[model samples]
Target: MRTGILSEVEDMIVDEVPIALVYNGISHAVMMATPADLEEFALGFSLSEGIIAHAGECYGIEVENGPGGVSVELEIASAAFMALKERRRSLAGRTGCGLCGVDSLDQVCRPLPALAPARGFHAAGVRQALGAIGARQELTRLTGAAHAAAWCGMDGVLRIVREDVGRHNALDKVIGAMARGKADPHDGFLLITSRVSFEMAQKASLAGVSALVGMSAPTLAAVELAERAGMTLLAFARGDNFVCYAHPQHLAVDT
Candidate 1:
């Protein structure tokens, strides 16, 4: 319906499905996502949400497709499972909601250690990565509803990319892929196709990523957290222009 005109048309759209992340037979969280990378999403969620300390803590991951939706079952270490049981909060996540179903205000923000200093990032590299990322987003090209998160090297090369209907899920997939590939988070920066939110910044910082570049604007809380965590936060990245919200010193001008 365009301007009150009724028309019949068929279009390609991104898939948004409920993905249940079950840990040790306990259903922890269910998020609406693209459902392409269930294993990566499960690993990344567990790591970013502090459910497990590291990748080694997660012994195994199994993906199950059912009639209703997809389920990702994870087998974690006993210590990590005990910790998860002690502080488990059920999350009912939607596509656009990051903090839905939080049981308490205290659980809203998780504590993270300050990130190590990141160096050798140039503005030219940021622009180069931004330019190349669009072509790599196959799902976005097919369905405009998809969002992507990319891990780029300091030289602006795209190392890994993950896409989903939800921005958080994409980032989680990237994190999980990075872990699986043994990529060093501090040696590169994260590029996202969505606005910089506090949760997004926190997730990157938790993964020891020192910089984040976004194609949209950044929230106030995101800037403040990035500053406190010693992260380089850049947003509104279009073409050769971008706004550095925090730690601008890390982005050097290329000669």
Candidate 2:
């Protein structure tokens, strides 16, 4: 430790690049995201943003790397492409702000899928998943700046983890990975390494995941919306402890 002499050193940072999502050769959105998992990001963003109903609707994905930014090409079904063209939501996401480019309230709360009724998850399982997630966050370990989203089963097994500079991007990546892996949305709960936001809850609901747990507190709006979507919202989740903001019926305390 030098006395008042701070030394400049290079550190491994999370790479944030502009990823343009293109559908049928038409640019739909350009988001600032971590460079890895372009295909998963494409698929996840498409599904989460309601661009495509399901992963099968996306025929293929192409990642074009460039000096400027990466372009993700999604060859989606004609029906989905037409829907995207009609909706025409070309968002330029700066960070994880879910409603960055939304112009009006009507556009803000778009239609979401009907999430099934709440399924019980053991308290011990949630605690185990929460405790295990820190070790699974590779990028957070590397850069300490990225957020992570992990899909944990009802039994509390950490199934998959994805990271990005943006929390929304991380969650989207997890959802996309789940879609590609054919993981049943009904079989698990999603845990995010960030606060619970309305859009985050909305995304989970759209994917039909019944539970959302966050490392930080939930916003009032997030809890309200999540309640409407039939999700069990838990936040401020620490070792052997968490606060359930909504739908406590779904959280079965392990005796």
Model 2 Cα lDDT, one tens digit per residue, 1-255: 369888987789889999998899998789999998879988998898888899999999999998999999889999988877766544333445446446456877777666775565778888989889989988898899999999998888899898999999999999999999999888889999899988898889888898899999888889998878878899999888899988888778965
| lDDT for residue 232 in candidate 1, whole number 0-100 | 94
Give the per-residue lDDT of model 1 (tens digit) for 1-255.
999999999989999989998999998778899989889989999899888889999999999999999999999999998877766434333344446435567877778777887878889889999999999999999989999999999989999999999999999999999998898988999999999999999999999999999999999999999999999999999999999999998789856
TM-score of 2: 0.92
Please give the RMSD of candidate 2 to the true structure.
Answer: 3.1
**What are the per-model numbers of colliding residue pairs?**
0, 0
Query: What's the residue-level lDDT of 137 in candidate 2?
Result: 86
Candidate 2 backbone collisions, by pair: none
Reference-based lDDT, residue 196, model 1:
96
Over the full model, what C-alpha lDDT does candidate 2 score relative to the true structure?
Answer: 0.87
